[model samples]
Target chain A: MSAAMTQASSQAMSHAATDKRCDVSVKDVEISFGRHVVLEKLSLDIAQSEFIVLLGPSGCGKSTLLNAISGLLDVNAGQIWIGGRNVTWEEPKDRGIAMVFQSYALYPRMSVRENMSFGLRVAGMPANEIQKRVADAATMLKITELLDRKPSQLSGGQRQRVAIGRALVRDAGVYLFDEPLSNLDAQLRAELRVEIKRLHQRLRATMIYVTHDQIEALTLADRIAVMKDRVIQQLDTPQKIYREPVNRFVASFVGSPAMNFMPGRVERGATGATFSLGDLSIPIQGYPFKSPGLTGAAVLGIRPEHVLSGAEAGPNAFNAQVEMAEPMGADTLVWCRTPSGASFSVRVDSGPSIAPGDTLPVSFPVGTLSLFEEGPDGRRL
Target chain B: MLAIRPRLASRLAAWVALSPALAVLVVVYIGCTTWTIWISMTASRMLPSSNFVGLRQYEALFANERWTVSVSNLVIFGTMFMIASLALGFLLAVAIDQRVRAENLLRSIFLYPFSMSFVVTGLVWQWVLNPTFGIERIGKNLGFADFKFDWIVRQDMVIYCLVFAAVWHAAGLVMAIMLAGLRGIDEDIWKAARVDGLPTWRVYVSIVVPMMGASFATASVLMATSVVRLYDLSVAMTNGGPGIASEVPAKFVMDHLFERQNIGLATAAATSMLITVAAVVGPFLYWQSRRRAAAGAH
Candidate 1:
């Protein structure tokens, strides 16, 4: 009897582990529209309750990947698994997934109640059950008061709330959002972004969100998959992606006022590897390198914030003439040209009074630098 | 004072710009309509006379069997033609919307009949539906000796033949309108509907059709106007044939005015049509304007 009990417990433990595993998996998905390939052998695995954001610029296959996962688009060749079931051949309705569109895509003629309950009604759920689900979702979204109004009558934020409610009522294993906040104003987008984050925390449902907005990705995602040219460039936590991007493209794409790229080369010597540009050679003693013996014609990347200002400058400090100063409320962005003729930008506190042609002493820290090989691939060195 | 002077001058210029349209509306539409109403109350037969007749012609019009049959035929034709055109047009639009190849060619082919005048459409259909030489002869040539497609001559079914011809000509216009509506819909809406698990038909009926209220209204209103003024098709196809089985109200008015030389009865019939149209359309126009005003206010 004890042995049987132990066997049952082992089986239960295995089931729990499976439950904690990836709830949605796309394996080698290839999608094409006629002669144009949107995604090539794209694969992604989303753990149970993990909020993953697919972040990229326009035409970068992020939304296409989301559509493929939701079964809204057919793959040329691949498999998709959701909740341990292969749903590659399934219709979108049968895939245990719900989606929110960038336009909200609410039925303009129907009341919010009808919009939220339409899927349930289509699935032939009972009337009372549909009512219960819609009510629960409406309450969760705080849109119960707007249930009687049509989509045209609601504000943009309210309509999106009802859209989220429509997806929530499905009780699906996965939720897909394709730029759901792109159509909103900045204030509403920020407000709803927080709401979506709160929603993920409460429900813990696996969600795959697509957006070109890096701020949205950084704020709302547990992990971000940065995509470019139909392939994921890097998939990691937002902090890791921000601090240690896999390539020059990912680094430039994620940060605002983007990371400055200076043409340079890496030279290895007795002291350490040094990044040299014109006459400026900065030692890379404390820099992290994904691979060793990094000596090449490379490009050095330094974010605007990483350029130290004021009295923090040490021995390696150099003076650069300011070409432009943009006051952005919280900080002033000072664009200057280095002695090596490289244009560099530094973000300083608003209290500093700086002007164009004013030379400021700034130091490049070794810790926060990103070095990439100068080639077509632009891989990190 | 300077701003007010310029505003007053612009207002005068606005009046000047609108004078031509106002003149046409008054002289052509309202003036002619008023004259017709006045002429309906007279006892004119060969020519309009000033002899006032108090609703006598209307009573005579209602008493005429041909007039009664014409009225009933219009109801049947209007209902059948409008419903069939809308249904067939919506279906065609949906079919073509399936990302079909050669879409421009198909759309042009479907819309070709609408480009033709109704008189030409009616004449072409008359030849194609001729029992002795058209489909009947073709069927017999194919060795089906007992085949009969003589609805064009049958009294009870001649109205249906007219309906078929009318639908053939008008369904294309309806299809074009519906296709425009379908195209105007956001592509993301379809994606959302699919993710919601709604069937294609349900999406059309519940979501898409309701969203296309303006398109349907435009198609139906155009169809309704044609139904009321259905003279040319009747004359060309059936010509009130099989002993007045396919006679329509407009044809009845035309025949009484010219061939029968009964101007009193014709004017009475025309006046009745005008009143009926006004009765139906007036309230609708008022409601539409009121709704627009409310919307604008909001």
Candidate 2:
């Protein structure tokens, strides 16, 4: 009995780690509104000072997951750990997480200083300490001169900075952001995105940001968690996700203009298994399809940039009819239809003035092909 | 060959439409107010008289201890009632705004009080607060025979009873105003404050209340006006009974004007109240409007 008690006490002591542990950990989290589930069995482990972005399509539970971390929405099943403390049922403040909102919810009647000091004041901190934190956060945000102005008196960018400053004054272990730049104009969004990146580097605070915009996720995150249909499709470095996506959703989600999924068939070739669409045969091998011989139907995931247009072709070159040419200043997007009636896009630096109905031979580099198995929901392919 | 610009014609038509309403407002409301002030200056009992009293009525008003007591009672009642009603109203509004079930039932329960006339309100409160016949008696029968709740009769504590019923009647309207304010709050604020690591109550206190300035102002003005014009609740509840304990300023002016047939003293009291209100309210309103104009500019 004494040995068992010793082991139990040691186990309990091991669970306790100071501020430098994993910043956020969600285990088997499920959130449902009545009967409709938004997030199901989602688990993620976030290391300290890592900037993680939740990127997904609308209704994909990215925002819901963020809320779960913030303790705004309770998970039906699962425990949330923040800085080595279980905070699944804790209040948002107790969880040591601060959030910046999409709409910049600044207090219209309060000056920037008061808005920043409100949380600390409510915690019954000394007035002088609250003022010091407010001043430091204001200076860090470059909003010291605007401290006396109310939110209504500030511009959208200024108000957003103050909102961020309000969160910074708390000096929590984690920061949660819910599409904080969605309210700004396009120009301001771009500018503030840079500012946020700089702020993250300076603070080295753990952050979990949610956004539907893939570019923001790609640019801002040290690690990106791509979500779809209440599940995390893939979580990896942004470049890895761009290069190697585990499934169709991750493949399509991580890139702009989306990756194209062309219907193809696997046929037995002399060397190995080869992909066939119409008369074109592209050789592919190994781990993606070894035993579960993809015969009936499969999808070939190819990005617009990978569809090379040149004199010499790669593995899967076929005749494609150009449907539309969209010139986007730096690069040209050539929308084409394949011989097998699949539509896709090709990116070129400066294409030979391709127009509608223009016939061109496009090649898909087989090494870059991401394959999905055929399933009933269509995600398997 | 038009006399003014095209936009000016629209302004002219607007002014033309407003002139009748403006005329009535100026003649009926402002004119009667000015006439009342003029009559109070004279030694008029039944009608306006030319005889100058030269501060005689003012001297008499100062000497009347009942009038003095009435003024003090009004101040006490007004402050307590306004603050209490506002707090209770805001709390009710916040609670209801949570979108709890049985919303319409709770709303009707709160709003039904505003549908009552002051006569009915005072009578109902009197019935409930009467020590021998009301809640105290009920409690006594329920086995607490030592119950002593005779605030309506006590001279020192009578104003509290007045505050209780007055707050009960006016808080509903304040709730409605605050509810509208609470509803107009952008849902994004709740989500943002949640993200900012604030508890629900902090969000309401720091974010929600501050953003609800216009609603609070509207509710406050409505309540304050009601405070100055408080009359019937006093008359029905206590009837200035138990030896003039619950008398308010409006009641004193009203009793002297109608029941006592002492128009000189009544008009004199009215004039004093007018001067007092102007002394306090005139500067306050000027400063408020000026600040509002400054805020609105640019």
Candidate 3:
């Protein structure tokens, strides 16, 4: 199923590559309320039919940026362009965009059909066209049976689907989603996340999504813009963002169970640079360094899956005393203390049956390690 | 058994807490209503007399032209007040919700009239509507010599003047209730409407107003009760002037009960009012409960 979906998405993406008119450009946008600054000098360019996710914590200005692009918010300074037309002064509807909000925002008194077709009706579209568009959107959302029902009669997932249907009926060049699935339960969130990915692949519309969920960002975005403190920390493909976060904030935020950090020092010696924690030293000869020959007061960061244990430890392995084990169905997350007294976790396959207090030989693969300068802003080394 | 004990103890506590309210409902409300209904069926002049006269007081009350006029005036006042107040109040709420400056001050200013008693409000409006010294004279002084603002004294238009004053006094309370409802609505809905290209008035009329069914119901109920009990406003403003043009049901019952020394007719009018109120409220309460049950079922 996954392979087929990816194949379909790739085909749709290539097909969508031809439509360059829908590209969106946000130029030097600054948004502020009174004395508090929410976003300043933010700029981004989205290609036609691209699925771009703005990933950030709450109050990080991700949703604010989305709102600015949608023309629902007025930027204090800057121009927003959709399809080469400056839409900064235009109303949201005239900007050729549709948005799905976190709260669903479905009109409670309107039926699913009415909710989806309201925009067309307001635009003075003919009755037959409105009916056809409503029908098409309802079918696309698989809510044809629920078209006559009110939003109050639907479940959270169903209401969100109706909201998406409302946006779909617009047939606008750009689509904006502001944490649309955050109100759903875990199971429903996962379900809708996959559905949204599929819908993006099928529609191939220029979609900008805002989410705090890294999993959603990773799974849905063609490119993820990780933001912090009203600034874009990193913007890259999901793989690149996961493998090469530009700074500590992006690095710590983009992964689940999070990357482990050890306060260590990179010393430049006659035998090349080596990272030393307490008495344990590891050569970082193969690691990619942004600034080579630089040393001292650095932090070594490694994901749980990057640490190998037992037979896979290879040569030059260190013994780690196991602290606890949490079995998560397919794998076990074992918390352990290194010989240097640094605490970290390892993701071992369920077959290993690791337990607390067990001493395991684990090796850090130097190629996958991320070394950062130790300070408040932990820029990559 | 332990669970039952705590449950019973909590139930007893609830009953104990409700005892005073229950006593008032029984002794003051139900007892007086029962005695009034009984007295309406008897030949009671100034005091209670057990000479049974079935439906005679009601016949007399219906035949009385003043009581008839009072009933019709109430219907007009009730209909006009309910619509005008709700419309004006809802508009005021929508206007205030536009992120305006001095919103709290504006809200308090709008709501100030409701804080005053109806008699005070009526007296204030009486001076304002008085032809010689009020708006008519002010208009004439302002150089419009043909201005004729005399609705308060004109017999055919006097009830409307009462309606105007009452709406002015009560629309603020309705505004407060409707404003609360407007605030309770999710802000995202407005954004969605804007994205849908809905005009502001269209959104209020089609979406926002429909969503505030509970607010409308609450405001209407309060206004309806005031309509049924409208006596002080008329007394203070016009005192059934211009040949009983502004007489209301409550004032009729009051005059018959004390000033006219006709307790039987007064009780009869009061009983008719009780029945009329029940007739309107019964179906409304039933429909509300039914809607609630239907909502819960889904």
Candidate 2 structure quality by residue, lDDT tens digits, A77-163: 999999889998988877777888888877777788888987677666667666776777788789999988878789899999999
| B198-298: candidate 2 lDDT, tens digit per residue | 67887887678878889888988888888888889988998876688788788888998888876777888887888887897899899999998998995
Q: Write the per-residue lDDT of candidate 1 for residues A1-381, one digit (tens) a residue.
A: 334323433432223222333399999999999999888888888889899999998999998888888888889999999888998989998887889999999999999999998887877776766787778778878998999999999999999999999998776668899999999999999999999998887777788999999999999999999998898999999999998888989999998889988988888888888888889878888677877876778988889999987777688888888999999999999999988899989999989699998889888898888888785458777
Arranged by TM-score, best first: 3, 1, 2
> Regarding lDDT, does 1 or 3 come out ahead?
3
Residues B1-298, model 3: lDDT tens digits: 9879999999999999999999999999999999999999998988878889999999999999999999999999999999999999999998999989999999999999999998999899999999999999999999999999999989999999999999999988999999999999999999999999999989988899999999998998899889999999999999988789999999999999999889999999999999999998899889989988988886
TM of chain B, each: 0.93, 0.91, 0.94
lDDT of 2 at A131: 76
Q: What is the TM-score of chain B in candidate 1?
A: 0.93
Chain A only: give the TM-score of model 2. 0.87
User: What is the DockQ for all candidates, taken in turn?
Assistant: 0.86, 0.46, 0.86
How many residue pairs clash per model? 0, 2, 0
Clashing pairs in 3: none
Please give the range of 10 consecutive residues that has the lowest summed lDDT in model 1 chain A.
A11-20
Give the higher-lDDT candidate: 1 or 2: 1
Sort by DockQ, best first.
3, 1, 2
